[model samples]
Target chain A: MENIDFSLVDWSRAQFALTAMYHWLFVPLTLGLSFIIAFMETLYVKTGNSEWKRITKFWMTLFGINFAIGVATGIILEFEFGTNWSNYSWFVGDIFGAPLAIEGIMAFFLESTFIAVMFFGWNKVSKKFHLVSTWLVAIGSNLSALWILVANGWMQNPTGMRFNPDTARNEMVNFWQVLFNPVSINKFLHTISSGYVLASIFVIGVSAWYLLKNREHQLAKKSMIVASVFGLLTTAFVVLTGDGSARNMAKYQPMKFAAMENLYVGQQNAPLVAIGILKEDSKETLHKKQDFRFQIEIPNMLSYMAFLDPNAYVPGIKDIVHGNPEHNILSFQQRSEKGKIAIRALSDYRNAKKAGNDSLAKVSQATFEANYANFGYGYYAGRDVHELIPNIPMTFYSFRIMVGMGVHFGALFLVILLLTLKNKIDKKRFILYTALWTIPLAYIAAELGWIVAEMGRQPWVIQDILPTIAAVSQLKSTSVQITFWMFFILFTGLLIAEIRIMTTSIKIGPTEDLKDSVKN
Target chain B: MKEILFNIFQFYYQGFKSMTLGKKLWTIFIIKLVFIFLVLRIFFFPNVLKSNFKTDDQRSNHVIEQLTK
Candidate 1:
C-alpha cells in the first residue's frame, strides 16, 4: 500500500463530528420537548384549566422554534452523510439506506404535515383533534428515531447481512434479521428515554425559573409538576433500560463491551470498576495471576451480564488486543483468509441462531483460521482483529459517565415525583433550583453519552465490518473545512434568531389568549 | 371561458398597474434571476439541489441499476 496521509482522515472526521454535534444540539429537544408539549396539552384538556392551556402554549412556542432549527439541522445531516462519508454510503447504503428512506417517507413527512395543524389549528380545530395532532407529532419524531436506531444498531451488531465483494458492500441478506437485530430495540428505547429526560428537564427548568421569578407563578407551578412527573418516570426508565442496553451491548458486541469494561480476555468473575485512572501502558493483576492494567473484585458482574453464568469466561481488552495463544493456529495469510471465514461463520451462526441450530453454527478452528487470515479490506483498513476491539480507556470512561448520569437522573426523577405527588413541589425552594440546574446538565449528559457511543466505536463507522479511514468521502480537507465554517456561521445565526423569537413570544404571552390569537 | 380568462388577465394587469409597472418589472426581473440561479445551481453546484446522491454520472447509473434491480 502507498503511504496514505492520515491527516486527511483526521481532518474529515473532525469536520463531520463537529457538524453532527451541532445538529444534535437541536434534535433531542425536538424529540422530547414535543412529547412534553403534547402531554401538557393533554392535561389542559383534562383539567379544563386556563393555566395549563397557557403553559402548553408557551412551551409550544419554544417547541416551534426548536422544531424549525431541528428541521434545518436534520436536512443538513442527509447531505452531510454523502458529502463527508461517500465511501460509507457505498458500503452500507444497501442496508442503511432502507431505514433512512422509510424515516423520511413515513416519520418526517407525517411529523411535518401534522405540525402545522398542531401549532396553527389550536382555535380552528376541536380540542380532541388538536390533542391527537400533538400526539401524532410525538409519535412521528419517535418513529423517526426508531428507523434511525435500526440503521445505527446494524452497524453495532451487523445482523441480517452478508458481504458482497463485487459491490464492496454488505447487502441485506435477511430483512427480518436486520429489523429485529439484538441491539436495535434496546438502542431505540435507550435513545427515546434520553430524549424524554432531555425534554422533561427543559420543561422543569424553564418552569422553575418562572416560578422563582414569581412571574406566571400558577402556570409555572403546574407546568413544573407535570414536567417533574414526566422527567422522573423517563429518567428512571432510562437507567433501567441503560443496564439492559449495556447487557445487550455485551451480548452481540462483546469486543465493544470488552473495550468499555476494559477487559483483557476470557477470564472468571470480574469487578465493575466505579472510578479509576486508566494507565493504558502500565500492567497489573487482580489476584496475583492474570496480567492487566487496573483490576478490582466485584465477583461475577461481567459474567452475570454477558453469559448469565458467574463462572463463564469474559475476555478483557488486553487479551483481545494481543490475541489469546490458545487460538493461535494461523499464518498471516491464513489469518487474513480466516477473517473472511469468520464473517461467513458469523452469518451462519446468525442464521443457525434464528433457525435454532446451535450444532451447525459452531464453527471449527480451521474455519476460524481461514476467516481470521482474510479479513479483506477490513484488514488493510486497520480493522484487523486487534483494532476491532474498542479503546479500553475511552470506552471505560465513556460507559461510566453515561451510567453515572443515568443513575443521577434516576434519583433526581424520583425526588421530583415524590414532591409533585405531595403537591409540595413549588414549596421546596432548593428542589425547584435543582430542577432548573438539571436542564443544561441533562442536555450535556446526552451529548456526552452519544459521543462515547459513537467515538468509542471509532476506527469503524460500521462497527467491525468497516474501518473509519476507508469510510470517509474522497473530498479534499479544504472542501469539508469550508462547508464546516459555513454551517457554523449559519447555525449560530439561526440560534440567535431563535432565541430572539422565543424571548419576544414569551414576553407577549401566548397571543393575548383570544383577540390577538385571531389577529395573528 | 373568455370572460374568465379576461378577468384573470385584468386581475394581474391591474395588480401590476397598481405597482406602477416599473416596480412590477423589477420584481419580475428578480424572479427570473432566481430561476436562472436555480438552473445554474443544478448544473454547476449540484449540492444546492441538495440530494444526498453523488453528483457524478456513475452515481446516476448506480441509482438506475438499484431501481431496476
Candidate 2:
C-alpha cells in the first residue's frame, strides 16, 4: 500500500474508461444496424423490390462508417490491456486472452471477409450470395461481441479459473464454465439487446427527420416499420435480460447491488427504490446510513428482485462492511484479515520453496488455498471500511437513468410501430419530433449501462481475485495521462468524421446513380 | 478447381476495381489502423510483461513480489 502510486492507478483507469466509452459509441450501432440492414436486404431479395434495395443500401452506408470507426477504437482498447494493465494481463491472460484471441481470429475475420462482398458486391455478386454475405456480416459482428462480453463477464464473476501458486496466475480450468457463466450470459444478452434498441432508435430518429422535412416519405415510412418492429422486439429482451443481470449482481456482487439501491442497512422484505434523491452526508453518518432527500419505493420488491422471495433478507452496505450475524454475512474486516493471511502464506510458500523446504512449502500452500477466496481484500487490510464501498450516488443514479430511459424507448418503439402500421405516423408531428430527439437519449442510456457496471464494481479489476490497484502496470502517471489526452483527441476526430460522412450520406438520400446522388 | 479459384479471385478483383466511395472509406480505415497499430503502439504502448521479463518464471516472480510486498 505504501509503495502503490494512487495517481498512476487513477490515470490508468481514466484512460481505459475513456477508450471504452468512446469505442462503445460506435460498436452498438454497428451491432444492431448490420442486422437491420440485413433484414432490409432480405426483404429486397424476397420481394424483388428496388425500393427495399435502396433502403438497405441507405442504412448499410451508415453501418459501414460506424463499423470502420468502431474497429479503430476497439484495437486501442485491446492494446491497453497489455500496456496499461500489464500485471492484470500477466495474472489472468491465460483465461482472458483465449476468448479475445478467438474473437480476433474467428469472429473478426468472419466479419471482415464477408463485409467486402456485402458492400462492394452490390452488382458483382449473385443476389442470394450478397444477401447471405450481409447476414454473415451481422452474425459476425454479434459473435465478436459475444466473445468480448464473455471475457468481461469473467472479470465480474471470475469462475472457471484456478490460481497457480508457482506461476502466480489464474489459469483456465473449465472453458465451458467461463463461457456459460450466468453473469456472462445475462451480460451478453442484455448488452447486445441494448445495441439493437439503440440502432432501432437511430433508424427511427433519422427517418423521423426526413418526415419532419417532408422528404423521402416512402423510404422513411418503410424504414420506420422495420426499425420500430425490430426495436420493440429487442427492447423486450433488454428488459428481460436486465432483470436477469440485476439478480446475478445481487447474488454475486452484493455490494454493487446495495450501492445501486442506495441501501445502507440490512433488511428482510426490503423495498425497491423507484426514484430517489440522495443527500451528501457526513463521513460518520454515511458509515451508519445514507440520507435520502426524497424517495419512492415498492415494498418487498427489492427482496423479491434479489432472491425471488419477498421475505429473503438483503444485506446493505453497512451490513457488508460490519458483519450481519443474523444473515451470516462476513464483515469487510474479517475478509481483510483472511486476505492478509492468504498473502502472508503465499510469501512464506515462496520463501520455503527457495530454501528447498518442501514440507514447509506444502503447509503454506494449504493455508494460502483456504484464504485465497478473499485474497484481493488483502490490499485493503488497513484501509477504511468506506474504501470497500463503491460510489452510492453514481451507481444508484446510473441504474435509474439507464432503466428509466429503456422504458421510455420501449414505449416510444411501440407507439411508433403502431402509428406506422396505422399509416398515421407521419402526420403526428410531436411523436415524430420525439422519435427524432430520442436518438441521443438512447446513447445516453447505453453509456450509463456501462457506467453502472464498471463504476459499481469499484476497487476490483477481477472480483475477489485482483483489486485494480495491483492490476495496473508499474508506469509513470504522466505516461498514462499523455496517452489519455491523445486518445481523446483521436477518437473525437474520428467521431466527427463519422458524423459528417453519415450526415452527408443521409442528406444525399437513396438514389440509383452514386455520382448524381452525391451531387444532389 | 483452377477456374473456380480464378473466378473467385476475379469476383473480388472486379468488386474492388468498381468501388467508388468504398475505396476512400477503405483508405481512411487503413490510415487509422496504421496510426493505431504502428505509431501509437510503437511509441506509447508496449507489452510491459514481455518487454521487462525474458521468461514466464521471471514474470511470475516479479508479480509475486508485487503481490506480497
Candidate 3:
C-alpha cells in the first residue's frame, strides 16, 4: 500500500466510464429493436398485411446495423475485463468465468448464427422460417442479458460461492444457487422491461416521424398502435419491477439501499427525499449536521417496499457501519474470524433448541458466513466504505427520472388511445404534432434508468464483495489510456458506418427500389 | 484399423479436390496458427511464467505474468 499511486484508479475509471457509455449507445437498440421487428413480422402473419411486412423489413435493416455495432463494442469488453483487471479476473474467475462462458457459448453463438439467415435469407427462406428466425434473435438477445445479470447478481448478493485462500479465487459452490439468486430475478425483469421500453419508443418515434411528414400514414398508424400497446405494458412492468429491484437491494445490499435513500442515521420511520442539493447544514439551535433542507419524506414507504411491513426497521448506513452490537461485530479487523464465532454461536443455539447434534451442517453454514464476511471485509478495506457505494443522490435522481418518464408515457399512451377510439387518429393534430415529439423521450428514460441501476453500484464492481479498484486491471495507467483510445477510435468508426448503412437503407426504402425484374 | 486408415485417406483426398489451391493454403495457415495458439496456452505460457516469477504472493502474480506474456 505504501508508495503506490491512486491516480491509476481515477484514470481507469474515466476510461471505463467513456468506453461503457459509448458501448451502451448501441446495446439497448439491439435488445429493444429486435423485439419490435418480431412484433411487426407476427402482425403480418396474423393479419396478412403487406404493409406490416414492409415495416418489419425496414426495421430489420436498422436492427442489423445496431446488432453489428453492439457485437463489436461488446467483444472488446470481454477482453478488456481481462486485460484491464488482470488480477481481479484471476481472483473471481471461478465464479465470474462461468456466466461469461455460458453467455458466449450458448447465447452469442445462437444469436449470431440465426442473425445471418434472418438478415440475408428473406427471399430465400420460407415466410414461417423467417419469422422463427426473428423470434430466435429476440430470445438470443435476452438470453445474453440473462447471463450477464447472473454474473452481476453474484457480486450484489455474493451467493453460492466462496474464495479459497489456497486457490486465490472465488469458486462456485452451487450452480443453481448462483443462477436463482434472490436479486437476479428482480434485476433481470427490471433490465429486460427497460429494453422493451427502449424498443417500443424507437418504433413509435420513427413511425411518428413518417406520420409528421405524411409519407406513410396507413403504415405509421399501424406501427403506432402496436408500439403503444407494447409501450404501455413495458412502462407499467418497469415501474413494478423497479419497486421489486429496490426491495431486493434493501434486503441483501443494505448499504446500497441506505446510500440510495441517503439515510445516514437509524430511524424508526424514514422519508424519501425527492430532490435538492445535499449539504452539511449547521444550525444555532441544534448540534446535528442537517443533511438537507426542504426534503420530503413519504412515511413508511421504504419499510413497505423492503419488508412488506409498514413498521419494520430498515437499518441506516451509520447503524450498519458504526452503531450497536452487530455493527461493531462487522467493523472489527478480523471480521471474517468473528463471523466464524457468530456462526458457531448460532449453531449452538439451534442445536440446544432442537436437541440434536447437527454439527456437520452447522460447520458448513458457519464456513459459508465466515467466507462471505471476509469478502465484505475485503471490500471495505479497499475503498471508502461510506462514500464508495451506490451513489445515493445520482441513483435517487435517475430512479425518479425513469419513473417520471414511465408515468408520463402511460398518460401519453392513454391520450393516443382516446384519439384512436374517437376515430380521430387520422386527424392532423393527434397524428402529426403531439405523438411525434414524445417518442425520443422514452428511449432517454430507458437509458437513464439503466445508468441509475448500474452506476448506483459504483466503487465496487461486485456489491459488498469487491471494490472496483480491486476488480480492475493493475496495468500501468498509460497502457489503459492507449487501449482506451484504440477502442474509442474503432468503436466510433463502426458506429458511423452502421449509421450510414441504416440511413441508406431507410433512404432507399425497403428494397422495392431494386424491384420489377431483380426479384428472385 | 485398415478400414479407418482408408477412410481417413479418402476424406483428405475429397477435401483436396473440393477446394482451390489458395483456399487450401489459407486453411492450412489458420490450422497452424491455432496449433501455435494452443501450444502457447498449454505448456509454453503458464509454465514459462511460473518459472520467471518467484515471490511469496506468487499465484496471482503468476497469472498476470502468463496473461501479459
True contacts kept of 1: 0.00
> Candidate 1's residue-wise lDDT over B1-69, tens digit each?
999899656645654454332353345345434433453233322342135544544453342233112
Model 1 lDDT, full chain set: 0.66
Per-residue lDDT of A373 in model 3? 55
Using Cα atoms, each model's DockQ against the true complex is 0.06, 0.73, 0.08
lDDT of 2: 0.90
lDDT of 1 at A71: 58
Q: Each candidate: how many clashes?
A: 26, 0, 5
Model 3 residue runs over 4 Å out of place are A2-4, A274-290, A326-372, A376-390, A421-423, A426-440, A496-520, B1-58, B61-69
Q: How close is each model in CA RMSD to the real structure?
A: 9.2, 2.3, 8.8
- Could you tell me every candidate's TM-score relative to the true structure? 0.77, 0.97, 0.78
Which DockQ value does candidate 2 get? 0.73
Q: Is 1 or 2 the stronger prediction by DockQ?
A: 2
Cand. 3 TM to true fold: 0.78
**TM-score of model 3 (first chain only):** 0.84
Range of the 10 consecutive residues with the lowest summed lDDT in candidate 3 chain A: A281-290
Scanning candidate 2 chain A in windows of ten residues, the lowest lDDT window is A511-520
True contacts kept of each: 0.00, 0.76, 0.06
lDDT per model vs. reference: 0.66, 0.90, 0.64
Model 1 residue A299 lDDT? 71
